[model samples]
Target: MIWHSTGRSEDGVMCHPVDGESWQKFDVDYPNFSSEPRNIRLGLAGDGFNPFGNMCNPHSTWSVVLTTYNLPPWLCMKESSFMLALLIPGPKAPGKDIDVFLRPLVEELKFLWQSGIRIKDTATNTFFMMKAMLLWTINDFPARSSLSGWSGQGYRACPTCNEDTPSYRAVNKVVYIGHRRFLDADDPLRMSFKFNGQPETRPTPRHFTNEDIQEQLGRLILRKPGKHPNTLKENMDRQGFELNRSKRSIFFELEYWSSLQLKHNIDLMHVEKNVGESLLGTSMMNDKSKDTSKAREDLKNLNIRRNQWLQKRVYQIEKENSPEFHKELSALSMGSQMDVYTYTACIINGVRFMVLSRDAQRKTQNSGVLTVCENGEKYYGQLEEIMEVQYPYDYSTVIFRCKWFDTGDIPDDNFISIDTEKEAYQDDQLIYASQAKQVFYIREPVNHRRNQNNNPRCVVEHVNHQNIWDLPSDNARVQNAYSDSVQDVDNVEVENVDIVQKDSSPGARLFIEFSHTFKAMLT
Candidate 1:
């Protein structure tokens, strides 16, 4: 058959060959392939699923999917371009027996490698040969080890790197991987660890050659013994066809196939699934179920994040503060229960409580515009949204804190620089999880202090029944209150009486007191 002659031997062009295999031609194709034959650039993918969509079924089947990178992007993923390579019908997991199912594909691949299929070159009006090359394999995490002939667990768990996972045995011979640390003799901060009283040292990573790995299999038989043709075992062995698929996976003795690197990619979907499974299993297996510390260290390699409630951003009361304040803050629930207590002085249930408000600013009657000094650190930071936190020491007692951002994107129109009384407070989604016990007050220089504490802005007032105009004019009360500073005082009076009825008493009392000096001038 006439093949795609990349470099014409008749034209005196040097066509390099190694082990009886042509090299330069791989990059060139027949004229039928537009200009030259497209490089196979093939990706082999396999996944097992039930065709019946019966979850209750115990049987399983795997399908080998083949797609070529040579195709245009739009057509690459089309069903028409996806060629089926093999189907491994199964009632149970194939395990190493997978080689049995792969025999057909292997035989076909060998034939294609040595004697390619013949087809007429439409442009040249002549028959030429063409071959497809296996470039890479793509499989989920479970299949990674089987396909790559590499082990992904134990001390040498990592398939791609020589990072030896440091493992130790506990009371019952249970192996647990520990945190990896770089040995630094010069750095005093690096806590030194010892195993069996011997200082632990970083291991020098190991490297293995493909041939070295293949030899470790001892012997391999790629085909079924029962189906072995009358051909002698000695003959197949001599020709190296008797090797297991894992060893044969090196594609030994094949002209161009021997050198082609068959890369097996890790499918993220499966990796994520496995990681989640491992965490769930570990959690449920424990008596505490949510054993935060031990489980976190045991599977630290996964770098799994703690649940949202345990994350760092959740504000917590500082233990440095008095234990009573911290204890009180810790006991608060999501909503008002009893009353949450803060040290800042405020009125709740007609009783006073203490709380802290640094650089408190009064809200404008028209707009809630407040300002405070920037003490070295930001007061609120990015959490501009406001939330009211109810103290649990008494009923109707509450303090305001900075609400955390929502899981979804905060609409710019909702959270951005809009000055509105209605939008100042956050919508319901901003509520903190139960464990976020410490109040996270807003500290941003440009913070929107929402309608909290019944105060418009930072202006605070005590509700009293007494009226200012009703105070004694003799200034006796004011003089008695600040006797050391003032010799006299003035009784506050209403210049214009708009006498309003209070509970049909036809009178309301108000009191205002001033120093003698100011009182004498005003009167």
Candidate 2:
């Protein structure tokens, strides 16, 4: 385990947390602590969840977990290795009071960092004083504010950007903008008029350093725990919006906190979920979308995107006033239209089937197959066209025209292999759409790839069509059928038993009869 933790992979890929630069930096800074590989490196994570499973209860529970990064990457993340350091039960999240609950854990970590603990190394059969470090804290956005004592909201909400965070009021919410500032100076988007109708000539915001953060945090008044959130807002407004630091984070109490490269890491899962939901909602223009009527109004107020204003644009539609439009509307209302509808695809028995013309254009074919069972004989074919015949009383029925494969020379095998180039039953082309079943054809691999015409045989595979809202039946029929020449082996075995018993001696005949009876019972 020690070798695995300290070694690199064959291709030099990072396979464990020890390979990270932060670990190396810590090791270089604290040579005495890095001397023993057995010393554990831990990460702290906390989140609030509902224990009752009923959201209406409004009760919340926060679990503080510690992960040991000394083990192999595969084993380190497993639940078995996780240490539940603390569980804070509540009718509401602890918020700023979380530091009060974290005090004991912080003191223990400080003791481990200074005095250390003596333990027996099971692998080495020796005792050594082991020390550990609190590498970082992981939490979602809201929990980050509680854990780090930093405001995750307001004009200067971003911790990395500090006072230079870009934001503006858009209708009812704060909209963060100026992402183009991070792009290359020569990039076309820097001069694009589509966004805010102005070029983004501003440079990217500067990242805040640890000393700068400490200086800014020292000037702020720490709000007492359990106070109304509005009170914190009032205090911040009084102090001014230039600073987002609420208080010195409780983590700073640790001796090595300032020395660590990253003290707080935002959980990626929550960020991904939020970004994905916003993208999908906006693209689909659903109720969850941010692109609302008021948003367009705001854009118009900004004197940008004149074409996308809420005002309707007039379009010329000469057909709407044409005489033919009234005639078509009357026919549709009366259900007396004489026109026949030709469709490229249709669904039958919960299976989608498409005509050959439409299916040919696709890379993967799903609807071209046509299979039918008539007079106890199964026929394989490809769909040619789908037509709907309408009657005067709004009655209609669908018909399918297909081209069938030749079955006369098909080999006697378990799989139905047919010559793709040959056609059979040409005169018998049309069938009621209800009789058709969906299927697909797979061409057999051959040595001559460049000459597909030389390898014309294709194996038939049937598709199972089932209702969406129904459970699958235990006794579903198998689709594969055996050729007529391959007789049932069970019947052949029974005939052999009859022939053997007739020529056997009396004792042998009695044994044969008993065996036959046993076989029949087993069947």
TM-score leader: 2
Residue range 308-413, candidate 1, lDDT tens digits: 2332122343434534343233323222332222222212122221222322332312111122234521111111222223323421222223322222322424
lDDT of 2 by residue, 48-80 (tens): 999999988899899999998877778878999
Q: Which stretches of candidate 1 lie over 4 Å from their true place?
A: 1-36, 123-126, 162-207, 215-258, 272-523
Candidate 2 — what's its lDDT?
A: 0.67
User: Which residue ranges in model 2 land beyond 4 Å of their true spot?
Assistant: 1-5, 9-16, 228-238, 301-306, 309-523
